[model samples]
Target chain A: MTLFPRAVNETTSRELRKTFRSPSEIFYPLIFFVLVLTMFPFSIPPVPGLFNSIASGILWTAALLAISLSLETLFKADYSSGALEVIHLSGANLVLVAIGKSLGHWIISGLPIALLAFPIGWALDLNFLTLWVLVITLMLGSATMSLTGSSISALTVGLRGGGFLLVMLSLPFFVPLLIFGSSAATNASLGIVPEAELYFLGGMFVLSLTVAPWATAHAIKIRLG
Target chain B: MSKPILEVTNISLSRAQKLVVRDLSFSVSGGEILRLSGSNGSGKTTILRALAGLILPDNGKVARLEEKLGNITTSSNSVIYIAHRHGLEENLSPLENLNFLSQVCTPPPIRDGVSVLETLGLKTSMHVPTARLSAGQKQRISLARLLMFDAPLWLLDEPFTALDTSSKKQLESMIDAHLDRKGAVVLATHQRFNCKSHVLKHSLPMIP
Candidate 1:
């Protein structure tokens, strides 16, 4: 096999193993996501139509926050511990490393949130078709979030108060994703196909997939310097 | 003497807007050990990083030479750099970390992870998480990369820190063995250690 795929495989597997070993890394964001979704119903009045009407917004917002929370430490540990330097010096392509890290983040954070949104949507009285649309939109939107967040995380890897900085820098980029993802779900709830919103999310995913890893590699280099 | 594997010419490096290395120039060839010695803030690490291609020189060039069909060609895979921080994950075992590193290495590692750990006297603790390992043991695990990868140029930054006497001696011998294979080393350290090769000391003047 060529070097790129092999390097990506090792990096992704290492990332997966590290995530698994630290239960809190996986659980904290997940718990935050669940809690945020769970508390929304209690905070709002007991209007059945209101809950269903706002379910898509609440679920997407929770996912976005949970992802941002998890992204705070995405590159911090690796950068401070010198793992990033070693990998870069080892002749492994940093672009591939970025891809692997984003993939791992999507698996742990994005995938779980997407799957869990189904049950949460059910609890919120969303219909079957809308729940599926929520899951699908989240799967695409969260992966894009992970990609965009990876670059920002690398940019702010070692700065003081970088967590808050990451959330701020990333939030602007995430607005479009949030708009389309929630709109898609909301339209699906109203028996609309939501094709345009889905297409937009898909386009953003492909665009970020192509650009984010390269940007992340450069960001890491700059931070290391 | 073999052709120079690395050359840094008139390189001026600045960290955080202050120049740390000013027009510094050096080169390392096969079977040579270039020791960078200086007091704190003298830019030994900066110079080493410049040589490793991690930091670009504002005024000069850093080049790595490779022999391709009897001609010297510039290449990147010639250097292996070990920074101050041990790159092993806190949660992963030494074996797992080494395995991951080996896979990422361009040319696959000649020596397996287990044998390299055994050579470093870390066989028993290879399965334990690196966070539980003592400083010296963790340092040994980081140094294990020397034996695993066959990169011709090794750039080590403060590699002697936290290493016990025996481990330091072992590292010196490893340097000797690597020199025996006609490989070059550019090391930055404060500790005194002996190697069989003729060591060239380059002191970076403290930036005022």
Candidate 2:
């Protein structure tokens, strides 16, 4: 196997193990995702026509917030316990490490939210076809969000009150993904094919995968320096 | 005399835009221990970080000679660095941590994880979460990396801070054995390292 994939796999497995060691950490983002989505129904009217119109926007926004909240933890623990120094000295590809961590973050936080989106959309009166589109779009968009947020998390890992900075830095980047994802879901609800929005979401996902790891690696190096 | 395996020439480093290490230079060959002695905040740890390739010196060169390949491994895979904080996860056992370390390490160490924990007197704490371990115990767990990596050079920062008397003796012996095996060490510490073996020791005194 090539070194990049091998290193990425090793880092991913370690990250997964560390994440699961605390059950609360593993479930916290998903819980936050559900809670934020639940609150939308109360704040907005539960009338079928009104709820369906706003549901896609509400779901994307909630996923964005939950994923961002979870990212506060991406590098903080490693930085605090000095594990990151060991990793730096290990001579492994830091880019691979960054990509692997983002992968793990997506698996734990993004994947579950995407899976749960179908049922949540059903409760919001979205039809089966639209619900399916919601799941796919969420999966793509959340993965992109995780990748983008990973870079910001890496940059702010050790700073005092970095959590606030994380939101400030990443929230603007999220605007594009939100626009594309919610548009896809809304078009699906309107019985349109939604292909263009889905294509845009996939393009963003691909762009994030290509760029986020390198950006995150540079961020980590700057923080360590 | 054996060729110097590691050399640092006239390196200067800074933190927070203020210079900490100014015009520093040192080298060590196989079977030698370079002890960086100084009071707190004297840039001992920063210098070690520079040596371990964690950060680059603002001015100067750090070169590590590769004995087998004749290629320099300047900032990668040739040095093992133990920083002030133990890197082991608080929720994971020593065994798990070592296993994870082995996975990430390039050209992994030959020592078995079980034997290394046992040798470091971590036999009882092998399966216990590191957070439950005492400070000295955690330090010992960090020191266990000496047995877990194949790197020829070690950069240790205040490795004896939390160790008790016996653990300190044990660590010294471990360092002695490492030197005996032709591995070099650069240790930054305020405590005296007791080694009965006839090994070359160079003390680099730092100005506070």
Question: Which residue pairs does candidate 2 place in steric collision?
Answer: none
**What is each predicted model's overall lDDT from 0 to 1?**
0.85, 0.83
Give me the TM-scores of chain B across the candidates. Answer: 0.92, 0.89
> What is the C-alpha lDDT profile of model 2 across B59-154, one tens digit per residue?
788877653322223233578888899987787888988887676666666786899999988898899978899999999988877777777898
Question: Across all candidates, what is each one's fraction of true contacts kept?
Answer: 0.71, 0.62
Q: What range of 10 consecutive residues in model 2 chain B has the weakest lDDT sum? A: B67-76
lDDT of 1 by residue, A118-215 (tens): 98789878988899999999999999999989999999998988899999999999999999999999899999989999999999999999999999
Residue A69 accuracy (lDDT) in model 2: 87
Residue A224 lDDT in candidate 1: 75
List clashing residue pairs in candidate 1.
Answer: none
Model 2: per-residue Cα lDDT over A121-159, one tens digit each: 898789877899889988999899889999999999988
Error of 2 at B101 (Å): 1.7
Residue ranges of candidate 2 with Cα displaced over 4 Å: A1-4, A41-48, B66-76, B197-208
What lDDT tens digits, residue by residue, belong to model 1 across residues B171-198? 9888898899988899988888888978
